[model samples]
Target: MADNTAAKIEADASEIITSPRVEVGTRGVNRVDTVYASIMDAMSNGEFPESGRLPTETELAQRFGVSRPTVREALSRLRLDGLIASRRGSGSFVLRRPDRNIKRFAPIESLADVQRCFAYRIALESAAAGLAAELRTPRDLDEIARALEHLDRVREQGTLGVDEDLQFHLAIVRASQNIFFVTALEMVGDQMRVAMQLSRSLSLERSKVRREVVQAEHREIVNAIDKGSSVEAAEAMRLHLGNARRRLFEGPQSE
Candidate 1:
């Protein structure tokens, strides 16, 4: 009986190893999202039963052909979504299967999709900025400043700085200290990255003047937040997003 049990464990491990691999760095999909999707697929198929321990980070890394850090990031997102729980000295365990009805932002594949993404951002981020202005602490300010500095440095180098731009916006969202806002942003992270990439690409084609204008707008938002003027912060964010939307749809003439 013990020999049969040992063989069954080995077979299960082999089945996991033979599972389909996640392709990292795919366009329109981030590494964490890829890993998360793969794990969720496994769960949906009952390959990972509830209350059953998941593969260790090392095992998942090897199986998925990704770095352990990538696996860890995927696991962190899973924990945040309440699909899994981790215990000290033990591996992560499945909690509940993912809800298929959860609304997720689709990839931004066209100009229309880009406009839609910006519309969502304008609504979500403008409110987040106002709340952040009223609720932010010194630590939040420091984080926002650091992200802005990174963005400025990248701009000075004449790079589009899509990642830096995303970081700046994410820092502001974090400053709001609202879990719902943060989670909402996190759910659409890939779409947001794509939108940022396209927006920056368009701005790059214009001139340095356009880039400087964006930087000025960012500074305005930060200043309002630092001053604790919630109304000003919201308006600043709204104006910035509105300008971005115009630039995206109406071209450089709108600038």
Candidate 2:
């Protein structure tokens, strides 16, 4: 009887594995997101009790037919988002469903939306930069410097460097040492990424001279922060964002 029950469980698991594949590779849809969604669905369906622990990473990889690395990545994201918790000796366990009350910006469907996002950033990020200049510690400076170095490398490779650019900005916000500022940015994380992508695409189409100018502006902001000049840092950030807005909207007119 025990052998029959084990066989039935394996058969059910096989049915799940062979069902229609989730669309995982499209734009904005990554393997981690796919796996995260699958786990959430299972939890919602009562496959796992509220206090029940999740299966081992190896088991998850086998069930998803994905590499262990991919499974680990999904779990990490879940942990970061507060959907799961891990114990040192024990495995991971569900914490709770993701909070639905977090405010998210609408998807950027047009250039106008991107501009709106920039406008919002100008207000919040400028203040954050000022505070960061005043409050940043050595560790904060190191993180910001690392992000800037990454941006420099990506730019040298002639890529858009969208991710690096976002990282640089986020590092600055984190350096502010203000939890509210960081939380505000995290709430709009998706919209911020889309805005950066659109802005980078437009920037890439401009002359290399324009790109250099923008890079110089980034350096100015960092310099002000390094010198602990709050006013200068804030003004530099404002100017940089304002220039970005104009370059995206009013670049050399087409013939």
Q: Model 1, range 144-244, lDDT digits (tens) per residue?
A: 99998998897788898988988899999999999999998888888788777767766666778888988999999999999998778877887898777
Please tell me which predicted candidate would have the highest TM-score against the true structure.
Answer: 1
Q: Candidate 2 on 77-138: residue-level lDDT in tens?
A: 45643457899999999766421211122221243345546656766777788888989999
lDDT of 1 at 44: 47
Who wins the lDDT comparison?
A: 1
Q: After superposition on all CA atoms, how large is the RMSD of candidate 2?
A: 20.2
TM-scores for candidates 1 onward, in order: 0.56, 0.56
Deviation of model 1 at 84, angstroms: 49
